[model samples]
Target: MNKKKPITPFGWAIKQRLTELQMDQKSFCELHGIPPSRLSNLIHGTRKAARYRQLVAKLLDIHLTEEK
Candidate 1:
């Protein structure tokens, strides 16, 4: 049986965009001036999405509604 690994929403979106851009997490973090550890925490769900919502939206080129 084939199994899929689970990922957090933030992790999936960032990973998808990075794959499309042929980029790596380290490079993306450096280019965006975001600390790698912060991204890592967000991806791993150690940090709440609300904590970095705006920055994450900016990185993904999407606008977040007020409720988010």
Candidate 2:
């Protein structure tokens, strides 16, 4: 039997925040200046670039750890 891995804490937090804000992918992408396809891929499990993550945290006004 294979076990499925959980999403990373950061990724999970981002997903939750997006849901809480009631923002859709297209709107989120536009707000963050990220390509729609790229944001979609990230939500689907692609690791977002570090810079993109930082920008996201700032734009969404979510506090991220220093390690982020």
The candidate maximizing TM-score is: 1
- Deviating ranges (above 4 Å) for candidate 1: 1-6, 49-51, 62-68
TM-score for each of the candidates: 0.69, 0.61
lDDT of 1 by residue, 12-32 (tens): 677887888899989988898
TM-score of 1: 0.69
* Tens digit of per-residue lDDT, candidate 2, span 1-68: 75534555666667788899999768889876797766544444456566776777787677776432
Cα lDDT, all candidates: 0.71, 0.68
For model 1, state the Cα shift of residue 68 in Å.
11
Tell how far residue 24 is off in model 1, in angstroms. Answer: 0.5
Instruction: Give lDDT for model 1.
Output: 0.71
lDDT of 2 at 19: 90
